[model samples]
Target: MENLKYMQAIVVDKPIGPSGLRLVNDYPVPEIGANDILVQVKAVGLNRADLIQSYSKYNPPPGSICPDIIGLEYAGIVVRVGSRVVNFKIGDRVFGLVASAAMGQYLCTHSQTAILIPQDLDFEVAASLPEAFITAYDALVLQAGVKLNQSVLISAIGSSVGLAALQIAKLYNCIVVGSSRTPDKLKLAQNIGLNFGFTVESGSFVQSVLEYTRQIGVDNVLELVGGNYLKQDIECCSYRACIVIIGLLAGIKTEVNLALILAKRIRIYGTTLRSRDLSEKIELANVFASEILPLVKSGKLKPFITKVYSLKDLHLAFNDLESNKYAGKLILNWS
Candidate 1:
């Protein structure tokens, strides 16, 4: 590896809207600390969090560095390793979550937060996996405790996280039902292995859930849209079911019937990929490497990258993601 002190990075100077691609270069290459590894970034996967960060609406923890680089997960080859780092060496292909600045051409990540990229996975696919798959794995498998043979409900199935959850749930042998607002999108999801899916605008959405679950309701619900649908989701949840809220695409404010929630003994948890402590992020990365990375390598857990953009096309990439014009993951390749 070269002893490069500076590298190109997409640095946002202001909180302009999605159309602004005014990222300047010449940002100093990040330095690795003990127990950290520096990666020469190959590609970055865009997430809703990136959009939020770019707009300055997502606040970073106090005294954090480079809050405006605006990406959360990336894949690359390790260019340097701190003296204390033992798990990886220079030239190892790796992918993982970062505190921030994943959109840049290089990043320094804690050793525990990074995992070796599977030999069979391409850089674009590797970049697209971590955030969505980890979030979905945490919500569906860990938080929700979705069991084999249980019925699960997922909203916004067209989103990358939702799609990843669907795949993971199916891998666990759970029965999965998905919902989306676009009929065509719902069809695409169904074709991709969702057991059942429908547009939310369909008047019989609740009835469809009941029919799919044989009137017993779903054992788990992954709620991405959180508006009037909260009531509908509550009605479709089985006794003692868990509902994990990962996004508020529809809106935040919603009325819940406490009596109904109590009667069903329902559990609701709101979660995000960002805002988690470093230890937790490292733990999740370990879990993924042990339990999920094998599947990814085997092609059982394939990442769905709907589009790829050059780093110079950051604005176009972000705009497509913000417009919700594509399904699955959108990747930004540094090459």
Candidate 2:
């Protein structure tokens, strides 16, 4: 362990609506356990999960120590190591997803879940990679079993997770189709190597997708919007298609055609990052290190960070994320 006594962080006494920022100050620094390493946080990534948690909708597991600090992933330098820790030491750079309490100055993480940051990567970009990239990898490779030459469609393509899915699909040589509600975002996605982009507001999303695939529907659909678009997603999916639901930005309730699902043999599954156990998170970290991290180090995979805010300005950061004016990731910097 290095010379460290206390650290600064953001805290929320009580979460109200998204109207005002609720971050507080001078929260105590965490201590390292036998298998944990204390990290001096440099940058933290913000996700929709933070927004949901702050709205009093998503709660952490029972017996959680800190319930008000709402952050999932971060990147930083290790400042102290526990007795049983082996993979990391003080001064090493690392990044990973945490259960909670990451929107602060220092965080203690299990050694197994923390991946060493690549030498070529910046802290801000590394912070943006973990949550969204891991979720995309899990959905496309682990759950969907997407292979080479398959057709994959991703909705809400302007989001960080959506962009990560598009990049991962392209890496596996799959044909990628991206959708957004705005023409500028669609054009931006196309410019960034997405093969096909469609505007959902114009109401020809299914037609554009069919034309792109020559009437053969996409083999896999990563559905981020879950309300009225559920039926549309089912309609555009191919026979025996795998549709993984990862978000409900549009709304939750939807009336779908069950007959179409049965007739086409479509499979639908819903998943989230915050609800997984420690073992599952360790496995995800290992898979990402072996199969995904190298791509980022090689410059094949890149994260686009559109905005960054200091830890004290968390409310402004959340406001920007909720406003949907940005196209990439919004991050919180401790420095």
Candidate 3:
């Protein structure tokens, strides 16, 4: 570490929930390894994982800079580059995901983990893109093999990841059907190229999805809500369809009909971006940089940041995130 001594960071003083977050001004700036770069954080994106980590319901994988800090993705200017790091130098704008401890004035991560931000992209919007966009892309495009003109159903369509899935699926000329408990959010999703939107009530939207696809069912389903929704997800999928389970917001345990899964040849994949190893993360970052970054730079893809708040008001931001009132991401302005 150079002469830079201290930085501000949010420490989980209580570690209970949103209200447990606290800010500290004199936290030591982390030392970077030879392959790492120190980022001067401009903004940080809030995710459901952040809340889970805050409450001790989740713990970051080993090697995280600070396990108690509750953040996953960040965007900022590169302030210091380690001796062997040549991919980025001082003053480069970059954005990427971290296992933990990104909600601070300075963060050190592997240089390969950071992608140079598009010149036209705002830091706040860039902050909102990494976790949601990367997860959506990996699950839908890479794992599910979603292709052009195929049809997809997204549960919890109002979420940040859901929105990112909607846009990416559309870019492939795929038809999108989305579901949300809130009617207004469904309507909003429809306005943004969603082929159809279902207001999920008592699990009735399964029939709506089937109807929308003319009883044939969708080609893929991004199953964000697990539990009871899994059975319905099975019902809504067509023969040979894939279901990527990215979230379990509804609950874990669920009853499934083995015959239906066997008969339809449905494939299910459960994925979590943060739990992966460093090498895997770097590989994913490379894919994102090559495939998605150009789209982002061309304005064909973008982050939907619904709200922005300062680090001091993080609890309020988390409250907003938990309320599910926003259509996309909630961001913290760290700059």
Candidate 4:
């Protein structure tokens, strides 16, 4: 440990520009606080949040490592633990979310938020789990009160978080309808037990959804495409249905029918993991550790990693993600 001094981290040179991400050597290793643990990062998950931050649309929360490093999730080996930390020790494999600065060779996070990596999970796969899965779980299960035999409609079904929502809803025996602009992604979503997978070329997906539910409308909607889908989502919801807005891959501004919301008594929630307080994040972590980790260990829940890139090739990885050609999470490996 004494021999390790400098670290390598991905830093955004131009946050407000279209693209300016690079790996920086000779970065200072972060110091661990009494409740924190230092991890030697093995892999980092690529997320749309990362891109949004790179473009200066989003900023890191207070207490993040630095302003330039934009990653939100990572998995690695625990190299050292703080004196007050009791749940983890040196050599434990762990994965978790961070507010920022995680796409580095080393990272530091509070011990309470980092979960022990299951024995059966690989480093790359583990790295992909936290951000997408937690967003899905928190939005659908915790906030929206999804129940067994209910119906859910997910837009952008090819996204990592959308797939996670589909699987978790299915785990509770919920009927799921997924829509994607890409026909191939719709087919893949169908193979993963989607009750209805349709291409969202236009408003036709709403008709397909109405036909599938016999015109009753869905009980829940995981709305990832934020623009026109917002209005369509309102049209397709059942009475008192919950709609959780987890992404804005489409444009953020959209007009919704206020009368429909009032008539249907719809509950709309917009959430992002990066801006939550420390206590809230810790609570989320505990819930994931107790409720979701076992499912992952048993193979009932899994991370969908469609592509892998070395840390040096991060620019190409970002390009690939922006192309919207991939169906699942993209991972960047440090080793």
Q: Give lDDT tens digits, candidate 4, residues 42-83.
A: 999998878887788787876677657778889999998999
lDDT of 1 by residue, 238-324 (tens): 999999998887788888888989999999999986778888988999999998888888878878889999876788998988888
Worst 10 residues of 1 by lDDT: 59-68
Q: What is the lDDT of residue 89 in candidate 1?
A: 89
User: What order do candidates take by lDDT, descending?
Assistant: 3, 4, 1, 2
Instruction: Quote each prediction's TM-score.
Output: 0.95, 0.94, 0.97, 0.97
For residue 129, model 1's alpha carbon misses the true position, in angstroms, by 0.6
Q: Write down the RMSD of all candidates, one decimal each.
A: 1.7, 1.9, 1.3, 1.3
Clashes per model (N, Cα, C within 3 A) = 0, 0, 0, 0
Q: Residue 205 CA error for candidate 3 (Å)?
A: 2.4
Pairs with steric clashes in candidate 3 = none
Question: Which 10-residue window in model 3 sums to the lowest lDDT?
Answer: 198-207
Q: Per-residue lDDT of 249-323 in model 3, one digit per residue for the tens?
A: 999989988899999999999999988888999999999899988888888887788889987687899888888
Worst 10 residues of 2 by lDDT: 17-26
Q: Which stretches of candidate 1 lie above 4 Å from their native place?
A: 1-3, 202-204
lDDT of 2: 0.84
